[model samples]
Target: MPWILVFLFCLFCAPAQAVTIPGVTTGASASQEKAPPPEPDVEQKKAAYRALADVLENDTSRQELIEQLRKVADTPPKEQVPVITPPEVEDQKTVLENITDVGRHYGEALSSRFAQLYRNLIGSPHKAFNPQTFSNAASHFLILAASVFTLYWLLRLCAWPLYLKMGRWGRKKNREKSSWLHLPLMISAAFVIDLLLLALTLFVGQVLIETLHAGSKTIAFQQGLFLNAFALIEFFKALLRLIFCPRVPDLRPFTIQDESAKYWAVRLSILSGLIGYGLMVAVPIISNQVNVQIGALANVLIMICITVWALYLIFHNKRAITESLLHLADRSLTFFSLFIRAFALVWHWLASAYFIVLCFFSLFDPGNSLKFMMGATFRSLAIIGIAAFVSGLLSRWLSKTITLSPHVQRNYPELQKRVNGWISVSLKVARILTVCVAIMLLLNAWGLFDFWNWLHNGAGEKTVDVLIRIALILFFSAIGWTLLASLIENRLVSDVHGRPLPSARARTLLTLCRNALAVIISTITIMILLSEIGVNIAPLLAGAGALGLAISFGSQTLVKDIITGVFIQFENGMNTGDLVTIGPLTGTVERMSIRSVGVRQDTGAYHIIPWSSITTFANFVRGIGSVVANYDVDRHEDAEKAKQALRAAVEELMEMEDIRGLVIGEPSFAGIVGLTNTAFTLRVSFTTQPLKQWTVRFALDSMVKKHFDLADVRAPVQTYQLLPAPASGTPPTPEEPTL
Candidate 1:
C-alpha cells in the first residue's frame, strides 16, 4: 500500500511541479494570472529539478513507475486497431511479404522436384557420375567436333581455289583501272568463305546437340560456343585479308612488305581472334545474374580493349597505311578529290583522339557516357560535314554565277578567270554563318544550351549584348565608310580630265573629306562601342579631351598645317595637276589629305609636305604668264634695228600652231634701260598661255639669233677706257691689261 501511495504521490507531484516550474509555462493559466511572474533564477531552477528527482529516486516509487511503464508497453491496441502506417506503405509491405512467401515456396518446390527427377533418372544419387554417363557425353562431344572439322575443311578446299581464281580476275581488272575494286572483292571473298564455314560448323553442332538430347545448360553452352566461334572466324578472315591479298599483289590494300604482312597477320590474327572469342563468350555470363553496374563496366572494359588493340595495329603500321592512302589519291584526282585525300589523312589522327575521349568517359561514367559520346561525335561530324558542303556549294555557285568567260576572255584579259567580285564577299559571309551555326549546334549537343539563357540573365549578358551592338555598329559603320570612299573616288574620277589630271582644289577636297570622314567615323564607332561594353566613357572622353588639348598645345605646327591645308583647298591656291613651285621644291600635286599633300616629282621621288611648309608658292598653270629675255648689244649698233630684228624673230614663231595658240601677243623689245662701258641692255617680252612660257622663251631665243645674223647686228663688246691723269704715278705696262 505504501509503494502504491508513493507512486501516486510522485506522479501527482511531477505534474504539479511541472505546472508551477520556473522558466516553464503550463497550458492552463492561474486565475486572473494570480500574481505577476517573477524573474527566473538559477537556484530556483535547480531546486525544482532536484525536488522532482528526489521524489522519483525513491526505489519503491521508481520500481512502481517501471512496472506501470511495462504494463502500458505490453498492452495491445484496441481490437479494432487504427492504422498507424500510411495506406500506401501498408499495402506495399503486405504485397511484398506475400510475394516473398510465394516465391520461397515455389522455389523450394521446384528445387525438390528437380532433385527428385535427377535421383530417379540416375536410379540412385550415387550413380550421378557413373562411367556410362561420361561415355555418352564423350561420344557426343567427339561427334560434334568431327562434324565441324569435316565441314570446315570441305568448304575451305572448294572455296579457296574459287576465291583465288576470282581474286586474280578482280586484280587484273583493278590494275587496268587502277582502282580499289579488287581490294573489296578480296575482303568479301575471304569473309564469305569463313562465314560460310562458321555457319556450317554451327549447323552441325546444333544437330549433334539435339540428337544427344542435351540439357538446357548444355544447349546454352553450345550456343555460346557457336557464337564465339563465328566471331573468331570473322576476325581471322579480316586478318587474312590484310595479309595474303589472295595471291594477287596488285590487290593489296596496305603498303606493307609481303613478308611482314604475312608474319604480323599470322600472329595478330590469332591474338585478335582469341580476345574477340573471349569477349563474346563473357557477354552471356555477365548478362545473367550479375550486378548491372559491374556488367556495364565489364562491357566497357572489353570494348576499350578492342579499341586499344585496333589503335595499336593502325599506329604500328601507319607508315604503310599512309603510303597506301596517298597512292590511292594518285595524280589523276581533281582539286576537290585532293582535298578529300587530305581530309582522310588527318582523319586517322582525329579518330584516334576521338577514341581516347570515349575511353575517358567510359571510365568515370559507365552509364550514359556512351550516349553522350556518340551524340558529341555525331554532332561534330555533322557540323563539319555540313559546313564543308555548304562552303563548297557557295564557292561553286559564286564561280558559276560570276564567270569571267565573257569579260576576261575578250576585253579584260587581265581579269580573273572566274567571277570573283562577289566570291570573296560570299565566302566570308558563308564562313561567318557556318561558324555561328556550328557553335550553337555544339552547345546544344553538349547540353549547354541553358548556358545561353543563364548568360542572358547573368552579368555576362551585358558583355554579349554589347558585343552584338558593337558588331552592328561596325557593320553599319563599314557600309558608311565604303559609301564615303566610293563617293570620293567618283569625285576624283570626275574631276580628272581626259588627260588623267584632276584639279588641285577638287583633289584636295576629296582626299581631305575622305580622310576626315574615316577618322571621325572610327572615333565615333569606338566610343559608342566602348560605352556599350560597360566602359566608363565619361572618363575616357575626359582623358581624350585632355590628351587632345595637350596635343594641340604640343604640336601646334600640325594644327597649323591642317588649317592652312583647308584654306588652301578653298582658296584654290594649288591643284593636283598644277605644276607648282613650293618654296624651293617643284612637283605635281599627286594627292592631298587633311594636313599634308603627296607631291610626286619628275625625278620619280615622292615628297609629303605639310601645308604650313608652303607659305609661298607659285602655280604656273593658274593663268597666263610672261617670258622675258635680256640681250646685251654693242653701243655702236642701232637699238631700234636690234629691237626690230627681235620682233621679226618672234613673228616667225606664229608658223607653228601649238606655239601660235599659246601666244597672247607678238614678242616686242623694250628700249634699253641701262648703258655701260661693256654694252647696253634690251629686253624682249611675250605674253603666252599658262605652262607655255618656257616653250615660247626657247623658240624666241633661237629665232632672235638667226635674225641678228641676217640683219648683221653686232653683239655687245666689253671695252676699257684709259685714264691719262693717273699715268704719272705708274704707267700701265703692256701686261697690265686695261679695265
Candidate 2:
C-alpha cells in the first residue's frame, strides 16, 4: 500500500514537467534556455521497455501493477503554455476618481446588504413561526420570568422598610427651610435604595442561574436577558423616581404639582420599560432564538410605537408645559431664568427631534442604540443639573450686598459699592462659564467632541493660561483701585480732632489725580488683557496716538481749555466750593473738572465755564475784605457833634456779639471829605474776614442811621413848588424851595 501511494504521488506531482523513464528521452527539455544533450536512439527505448517488462514479470502482484499502469496511461497530462504578462496603466487615478470609485463600491455594498435583508424578511416569518421553536422559547421565557419575578419580590420585601423610611423623609414638610443639602441627600438615598434593590435582584438571579441552570445554555441565556432588561428598566425608573418623587411632593425638586408629577412618573416609567425591555431583551432574544430579520422587524415596530407615544405625550402637554415653565421662569430670579424661558418655547420641537433621532439610530444601528441613547440622556441631564446648581449658588452669593465693617466703611465708603458692582459682573461671567463648560461636557459625552484630548492639547492649555492671567489681572486691578481709593479717602477724611481737613484746592487736585490714576490703570489693564488674548496691541496703540493727534489738531479750543485749566489748577486759582466770579457769572464754584468749572450764581442759575472761556476771574474768599460806610449831615449842624455820633456808633458796632469777631481792625474815620449844598459826608472803614464785607457793611449802616437820628443830625433838603402852570402854558415859572 505504501509503494502504491508513493508511485501514485510521483505520477501526479508536477504534471507540467515531463515524466522520466529509464533510458527513454523526450524533447520537453529543449524548451528551456539551457541546451539539451543528444537524444536517445530507438534501440535505447526498446531496451528501457524490456527492462521495465522484466521487473513487472518478476513482481508477485503483476495484475494489479498492470491495471495501475493502464490507469496511469489513461490519465491525461497537464499542458503548460508560455507565460504572458499583463500591460500596466501609464496614468494614475485622480483623487476625485478614487473617491468616486469608493462611493460606487459603498453604494453597491449597501444595496446588496439591503437586498439580502429584504429577502430574509420575506422568508423569516415562515421559518420563525414553527410551533416547536415557539414552544421551546415560550417555555424558557416563562421559567425566566417566574424566577425574576420571585427574586424581585423577595428583594422588594426585604427592602420595604427602607423604602418606607425614604418615602417618609421625602414627604417631610418644611424641607426648604432645612439645609440646602437636604434635597440632594434625600434624593440620593432614594436612588441608592432603588439601585440596591435592583442589584440584589440581579445578583440573586445570577447566583441561581449559575447554580441550578448552569448546565442549560438556553435557560442561562433567557435568565440573563431577563435580568438585564429588568436592571436597565429599573435603573431608568430610579432616575424618574429621583426627579418626580410622586408620593413625596416636597422632594420633587422641580415645581410640579402632585397630580402632574404622578402622571408623568407613571407614563415615563411605562415608556422606559417598553423601550428598554423591548430593545435590550426582547429583540435580542428573538434574534437569537428565531431569525434576525424577525428581530429587526420587531425593533422597528417597537421604535415606531415609542416614537408615536412620545410625540403624543409631548404635543398633548405642550401648552401646559410651556405655561408651567414660563411661570417657573417668572418666579425664578436666577441667571438661568432666561434660558429656561427660551427652552420652554422650543421644548416641544426638541422633544420631537429627540424621538426622531432615537428612531433613526435604532433603525440604522439597533445593537448599540439603546445604550447610546440612555447614556447620552443620563449624562446630559446630570451635566445640566450640576451646572445649574453650581451657577445658582454662585449667583445667589454674588447677588448679596457685601457689608463692610464700620471701620472700613468709615475709612473707605466707596470700596463696598465697587466690590458689589464687581461681584455682580463676576456672577454673570461665572454663569456664562458654567454654561459653556456644561455644553462642552455634554458634547463630549455624546461623542460630538473629545474634550479630554482637547484639554490636554496646546490650544486648550494656552486658552486656560490666558483665562487665568486675565482673572489675575482683573483681581489685581480691583485690589489696586481699592487700596488707592482707600488711601485717597484717608487723606481727604478729617481726623477725630478735625484739625487736618483737606483744603478745597488740595481736594480738587487729589480728585483729579485719582481720576487720572484710574484712567491709567484701566488703559494698562485693557492693553495687557488684549495682549494676553492674542491681540496685537501695537496697532491699537498706534491708532490711539493717531486719534489723539487728530483731536489735538481739530479741537484747538478743547486743547486750550485743558492747558489753561491745568495752569489754573497748578497755580491754585480756584477750587470747588470757592466763591468766585468768572466773566459775567459770579457764584460759588460747585464743581471743577479738567477743562471746565461748574458755578451756581446767586440767582440760582448754574454756569459751566470752560477755562478757555474765562477771561476775568475773581475769588471773594481769598483774603481779608473791607467794609466802608458813608454818612451825611446838615452843613449848618455841628460837624463835631456828628463826628462824635459816628464814633459812638462805631463803638456800639464793636460791642455787638455777631459783628465783633468779623471786624479785623478798629474803625478809621475820614472827617469831612466832601461838602455839599445840603449835607457833608463822613466816611468810616473797617477790615473784616474774607467774604464778610457785605455783612459788616449792612450792620455799620444801620448803626450810623440810628446815631445820626439821635444826635439831631438831619441832611438839608431842597424843594421845588410849581405855580399854577401859568394859565395853560402861556408862561412857565421856576421856583426855589426853602430848606
Candidate 3:
C-alpha cells in the first residue's frame, strides 16, 4: 500500500482513546495534553485501545457496560403540560435523576418533590459540566426548593413565638379567656413571622445569585458568606433561646409560701431548659460515634440507669407491693387470692424473661459457643411462647374463679368497663407490635439487609437519604409514640391497689415519669435499630446520658420522688384509706403513694406530702382501740347522786339490747372524775371493735343522753354573768336615786 494510504488507515483504525466512552468521542486536542495522567495512564490507554479492538472484534462487554450506565437512571423526559410551570416539571425530572429507589417513589412523594425543589434553589449550578436543559431545570428546581423549605421551616420555627404572642394578646384583650394555648394570637403571629423569614431567605439568596450572574463572583461569594453567617446566627440564637427561654414567662411568684404551683413550675422549667441545652450542645458531638462504641456506652448507661431507677421504683412501690405481698404472705388480700398469688409469682418469673429477647435476636451465642443460633431461636420461641400462653390462661382462670366482693358487685359496671377497655387495648397493641416486629425480623432474615447496608452507607442518592430519614422519623416516631402511649395506658389500666389520684400535681408527676420512660425506651430502640443497620449512634448515646444527668441534676425533686416511690413499693410504707399523721397535719390517708402522701383532714382539707419526707409510718386498723370520756352533770344535783346515776346509766347502757353488741370486751365506769361550780364530771371507759369505735360511741352517747333526759338529770351549761361597770357611772346613779 502507498504510505499516504497507510497513514489514513492507521489514523482511522488506531482506536482513539480518551477514556473511550463507548459511543462518545473526544479529539486529541492540545488542551488534553495540559496535564499528564497518573501512574499506568499509558497502560490504561493501551488496555482501552486493546479492549476497543477486541470489542470491535466482539462487542458483547462494551454493549453490557453501555446498557448498565443507561439503566442507572431510568428517567422519563419532562413533558410540558399546561398550567404546570416549567420549573415544576424540571423539578420532577431532577428528582427522577437523583433518586435511585423504585419502591420509595410513591412514599413521601410530595415531600420528595418539595425537597428536590429546595435542593435546586440552594445547590450550586454547574453550567459547564451539566447540559443546558438539565442545568436550567436544576437551577429552577433549587429556587423552588429554597422557597418552600424556608417557608416551612420558618413557619414551624415561629409557631411557639406566635403562640406566645397570641396568648399575650388574648389575655390582654379578655382576661377571662385565658388559655394554655392562645390559638388566635398564635395564628396571627405565625402568619406575620413566617412571611418575614420566607421573604428574607429568598431575597438574600436571590440577590446573591443575581449579583453573581450579573458580574462579580467576589460580590456573590460574599453574599453567600452572609447567608452562611445568618445560618450560624440563627443556630446560636436558637441556643440562646433554649438557654434562657425558662425566664421568658417571669416565674417570680413561686418564692411565696402560698404559690406551690409556681415553685414546682419554676423547678420544671429550669430542668427543661437545662435538658434542652444539654441536647443542643452534646447531641451533635455524640452523634458522631460508631454504633459499637455507642452501643457499649448505651448498654453501660442503661444498665446503670436501670439499676438506679429500679432502686428508686422499689422504694416508691414498696408500700404498695409490700402490702400486696403481705396480704399474699398473710393470706388476707380479698378475691382470687390464690389466683393473684399465682399471677404475681408468674410475673416475677416473666420479668426475668425480658432479657431472653436479646438472646433471640443474637446472631451468635455469647454464653455458649456450641449453641447453634437455629437451636437458640427455636428454644426462645418455645419457652417464651409457652410461658406467655400459660400466663394468659392462668390470668383468665383467676379472673373467673376469684372471690367475689359485694363492693365489686355494687360497682360491677364500672369494673367491667375498665377491665374490658384495658383488655381490648392491650390485645390490640400487642397484636400490632407483634406483627411489626415479625415483619422486621423477616426482612432481616431475608436479603433486605444488603439493601439496607447500601442505602445507609451513602450509596443511595441524596433524595433516598432524605426519604429514609422521613420514613425513619415517622416510623420510629410512631414506635416511640405507641410505646409511650401503651406505657401510660398500661399504668392507667393496671389495677391500682395502693393509692388514688390524690392531687393534680401528683398526677402530673406520675404522668411525667411514665412519659419519660416511654420516650427513653422508644429512643433507645430506634438508636439500637439504626446501629444494627450500621448508623453511627455515638452522638445519640452521649446525648441521652448527658440529658439524663442534666435531668437528674435539675429535676432532683422528680428524681427524689421516683426514688421515694420505689422505696415505698418495696417497704409497704402505706396505702390509701389508712389513717396517718405527719408533722402538725393529721388526716385520713386519702391517697398513699411513692411520690407523695395525701391526707384528708377531718374538716375535708387535703394535705399532700412527698414520701421522701416520711421517715416512719403508723398504720391503723392493726389492733383494738380505746375510747375514754367524762360526762358532766348539773351541780344542782349532788355530786354523789350524779356519780351514782352515771354508773347506773352505764350499767343500763351495757345491758341494753341495741348497744351491747358494739362493745368489744367490757365497759368500765370511773365515778366522779371532775368538779365545777355548777356541775360535776363522771369518767367512762370502754374497749370497742376495730374501725367501728366511732359508730359504737355515737350510739352509746345517744342512749346515755336519752336515759339522762328521762331521769331529769341535766348536762351542765356554763354561762358568764356580768355586773354593770360599777365605777364608770356611780355619780349618775346617785343623782337618779336623789330625784
Candidate 4:
C-alpha cells in the first residue's frame, strides 16, 4: 500500500522547476513556451487532490457529509457555460496548433500510406495494371459509399417525422416501447451504415495502395474515389448524430437538451474538408498533385455546409417556457408578465425566421450581397425593437383591462395559478431575450458572422479556425461557471427551511457536481479555445501520457479522490433524507458534500464526516421502520384478558379526537415484550406511512394510557431487580415474568 502511494505520488507531482529552452522563440510568452513556472501551486493542487482523495479513502465519514450537502448544490443557473475547457494547459495556442497538425496528419498519413502502397504494387515496371481486378474493386467501393450516403440522408430526414408519428401512435396504444423502438431503430440503422462505410473505405484504401493504377478507365476510378470519400463522411456524421440523440428513459421529458443531430453537419463538414485537405497535404509530402484541384473544390463545399449549420444554431427560435420551479420559493406574478411572455415568444420566432432568411441571402452571395446583408440586419433589428416596445405597451394595457375584482380574487385559486404562471413565463422570456440580444451584439462586434471559416477556406482554413474559436469560448466559460456556482450555492444553503448548513448531504452533492462539471468544462473549453487560438493540445496529451514519471510525483491523492467522486455522483449512491449510523454514532443526514459528510445527531448536534472514512455505514432510512409501544396493565387480570383489554383499549383510542390521524390502526400485543414478576407489560405495534410511524406510535401510546385508566386497569409497580446470592448461589430466582 505504501509503495503504491509512493508510486501515485510520483505520478502526478509537478517538477521542482520549469526550465526554459534557452533559445526558443515560439512566439508566445516564455512561460507558455514551455509550461508555466512549476508552482508551489502544484502543492496546492496536490493538496486539493489529497483532500478529496483522503475523503474517499475513509469510508466511515462519507455518509455523514452526504446528508448535509445533499440538496444544497443541486440546481443550475439560468445559463450554461458555452463550452468546457481544461485548466492544466498553460499555452493553449501552441497546443491547439499541435492538435490541428495531428488531426491533419492522421487524415493525410492514412491516405498517403495507402497511396504509396498502391504505387509500389502497380507503378513498378514489373507489374501490369489488371483491368478486371481494378474494375471489380472500384465498383465495390463506389456502391458501398453510395449506400452509406443514402443511409445517412434517409435517417436524417426520417428522424423527426418518426419521433412525431411514433409519439402519436404510442399515445393511442399507450406503449412507451413504441417511442423507444422508433428512435433506437433509426439510430441503429444510421450506425450500421456508418460501420459499413468505414469498412468499405478501409478496403478501398488497401486496394488503391496495393495497386498503384485505377486501371485504364480514369473516369471509373474517379467516380469510385469520390463516392467512397463522400460516403465515409456522411456515415461519420450519422454516427455522431446517433450517439448524441437522447432516447434514454431517465432523461426529463419535453425539455430542451443539446441538439446532437444538428451538430453532425459540423463533424461531416470538418471530415469532408479533412479528406480534401488530405489530398492537398499528402500530395505535397509525396510530391503528387493529380487530384488536388477537385479535392480542394470539394473541401470548399464542405466548409460552406459547415457555416450554414452554425448559422442555423445561432438563429434557432426560443419560445417562452414557464419556470415551474420558481414557485418553490412561493412568489406570485402579475398578468402584465403573461402578456410580455406571449409577445416575446411570437417576436423571437419571427426574429429567428428573419435571421434564417439572412443566412440564406448570405449563402447565395448575390451581387452586392454583403452590403445588402448588413443593411438588412440593421433594419431587422430596428423592426424587432419597435415591435417589442409596442408589445410591451399593449401587454400593460391588457393587464389593466383584465384585473380580477376583489370578490373574485377572494373566491379563487385557479385564477392565481394561471395568472402567475403567465407572468413568470413572461419575465423569464424578457430576461432570455435580453441575453440573446446582448450575445448578438457582442458577437457582431467580433465579426461573429465570420466565425464560419471551414466553409470559407476548407480544411486548411478550418484547422486554424477551430483553435481560435476554442480559446475565445473558454475565456467566457470560466466567468460564467464561477457565477453560476455561486448563485446555486446561495439558493441551496439559504432556502433550506432555516436549517443550519455545511449540511453534509447537500454539500456532498454540490461538491460532487462542482468537481465533475468544472473538470469537464475545463477540459473541453481548453481544447477548443486553445485550438482556436493556435495551440495543439494533442501533443500535450500524448507527451503527458508517455511520461510516466511526472504524474507519479504530483498530487496522487487529488486525482484518485476526484475519480472516485465522479463515479459516486454518477451512481447517486446516497441522497438527502436518510438516517445513517457510522461506527457507534448515529444521526439523520443533514447535509452532504464531496469533501465531507455532515450528520445531524438525534441530540441536535452535527458531525462532519469525511468521505474517505466511511467504511461501514448502516442506513435505517430505507424501507418501512418499526414502531414500539409499552403499556402497563393490572397484575390480577388474566394474562390473555389483559392482552385483549389492551387491544380493545387501542381500538377505542384510535377513535379519540387528538390522535386519530397519527394512529395507523388498532395496535397488536407482542406478548410481554419485557418481563417482571409483579406486573404485566404489553407491547403493541402498528404500521404507518414512512416517516410518520414515530408520531403515530407516540399518539397511540398516549391513547393507550388514557384508555387504560378509564378501564380501571392497575398499572405495573416499578421494580429494580437485584440478587444478593441465590440460596446455593442459585436460590430460586423470582419467577417474575413480564406480559
| lDDT top scorer | 2
> Where in model 2 is the C-alpha error above 4 Å?
1-137, 153-187, 212-214, 248-251, 497-499, 716-739
Q: Write the per-residue lDDT of candidate 3 for residues 1-739, one digit (tens) a residue.
A: 6998985554343233222233222334234555543333555557656645655454455565456445433434343211201111122356666575554665677467545534433452433333553344335435544654575466656566654665456555444656634544444454455445645765656654663433545334433433433443343333333323333332111122224334434443443333222222222122222233333233334334433443454455445544555466455323335445655555543433432333222212222211233244444455445544554554454445233365453323234444455455445445444444444444444334544465457654554665456556645555555555554544443233553434333344455566677677667667766765667899888987999999999989877886986766555455556666677776677764546778998998998888667776665554666678778888787666666666677777778765677677777778777787878888888886656667767766876787677677888867665444457745533332220
lDDT computed for candidate 3: 0.51
RMSD of each: 18.2, 22.7, 35.7, 30.1
Cα-based TM-score, every candidate: 0.55, 0.78, 0.31, 0.30
lDDT of each: 0.65, 0.79, 0.51, 0.52
Count the clashes in each prediction. 3, 0, 36, 114
Better of 1 and 4 by lDDT: 1
**Candidate structures ordered by TM-score, highest first:** 2, 1, 3, 4
lDDT of 2 by residue, 553-597 (tens): 999999999999999999999988888888777899999998899
- Model 3 misses residue 705 by how many Å? 1.1
The best candidate in terms of TM-score: 2
Where does model 3 exceed 4 Å of error?
Answer: 1-541, 562-573, 581-587, 600-608, 612-622, 655-662, 717-739
**lDDT string, candidate 1, 247-318, tens digits:** 445446656677766656665665455444434444333333333344444656666786787678668777
How far out, in Å, is residue 380 in model 3? 37
What is candidate 3's TM-score against the reference?
0.31
- What is the Å distance of residue 407 in model 4 from its true position? 28
Clashing pairs in 2: none
